[model samples]
Target: MTAMMDREAFEAALRQIGAERYHHLHPFQQMLQNGQLSREQVQAWALNRYYYQSQIPVKDSHILARLQTTELRREWRQRIIDHDGQEASEGQPAQRGGIEKWIALTDGVGLDRAYVESGAGILPGTRFAVDAYVHFVQEKTLLEAIASSLTELFSPNVIGTRVRGMLEHYDFISRETLAYFDKRPVQAKRDSDFALEYCLENARRPEEQEAVLNALRFKCHVLWAQLDALCFAYVAPGLTPADAWQPGTAEKENPRS
Candidate 1:
């Protein structure tokens, strides 16, 4: 049987996971901040990352569906609204949601929405890692699923750094283009706070605590690997996957072609 754990120690373990594995350490992110990538590489990144952006609310909704309390559901539902928008009134086009805003980012970077949404340009590692996250949430214990979200514990600072660095270094990217991030720090805070509390409260055994911490570590790896693949394929001379998106080429217009 798994040993029981104290809450404080478990919390410490989760923080340690963040300290070691978060994508803030990724060389690609560093190069990006340092102005090393070409315009095309940056465009490819924004295009591929649209898949991750689109997946966020789906993951949140799956996690939200498992929470039993009305109050908890209330807390979690805001995440959906943040990504999907409130809905259309009778007259106006449906208010633009986070996904739409993300499309704006891709458009700003010169990627076609069809190509980005098709996910043709995304790294294989990105697809695998993101799929792992969704599967983890659906298959793991609720406490562990919540724990996986604790990556946001470390996200605000990184997001701040990214926004400032991208704005200062990249001439092609503008504040309006990066608006998707503007509300993320705040949203990440609210969501992570709730998830952290859930994990700390429910992870009552040493083994259980460790499991949750490891879940967070797994999620960190998921984020880190995406950047690693991007660096290898886009920044370095080679390593692009066979099926990966090649910038500057349009998708074939004919269905059979």
Candidate 2:
């Protein structure tokens, strides 16, 4: 069996996972931040990323269902509403539902709404990694599932970097087009803070602490792999999956312009 880690060491390991494997370091993200991607490349990114955004509530619900404590479930359930929104009659839709805003991003990019929702054109890696995350939450011990979500602890910084970089680099992108990220940093902090406190208080042993740290690492890989797949498939050209989106399937020309 693996050796156990204390609280300090466990926290350090989680931070190290963010440092080493987060998508911020990926070359695709660097290209995006530096204004190197073409308009088509950005569109491809938005369309594929919609899949990830749509899956968040499903994963959160799975985690919530697994929580035995009423207090824990109550804490976890808000993340679902944050992403899915609890609109009654849906006049304008809720102000902060992440899913509706993600669709708006795809619309801004000029992708066909149906194409994005069908998920037929998403990369195999994106599907595999995202599904794996949901599965991990459903199948693993509830403690580990909550611990895996600690990726949100690092998300706010990434969201800031992405928003600023997207605006600075892409003249075609406006603040409005990128609105999906505006609320995420705050939401991520709120969700992750709750998850971190839950894990820290519940994981009483050195072994459990180590498992929690590893779970964070696994979640980091899950996020990183999605971007890496995008980089390899869309950025490089001719490397895209057989079923993934093409250069002009939804529309011809740079839709952003």
Kindly report which residue stretches of model 1 are placed more than 4 angstroms away from their true locations once superposed: 1-5, 88-95, 250-257
Instruction: Summarize candidate 1's per-residue lDDT along 1-257 as a digit string, tens digits.
Output: 65675677767877878888888888888877777878778876787778888898889889899999999889888878888876677886675678888987887776766888888768888888888898898999988888888999999989888889989999878898899888889988988888898888887677788788788888988888888888888878757888887756643344221
Give candidate 1's TM-score. Answer: 0.90
TM-score of each: 0.90, 0.91
Q: What clash pairs does model 1 have?
A: 4-205, 4-206, 5-205, 5-206, 121-245
Highest-lDDT candidate: 2
**What's the distance in Å from true for residue 247, model 2?**
0.8
Cα-based lDDT at residue 254, candidate 1: 45
92-204: candidate 2 lDDT, tens digit per residue: 65455788889878878788887888899898999999999999999888889999988888778878777888889887788888888888888889988888878877888
Q: What's the CA error at residue 244 for candidate 2, in Å?
A: 1.3
Query: Lowest summed-lDDT stretch of 10 residues in model 2?
Result: 87-96
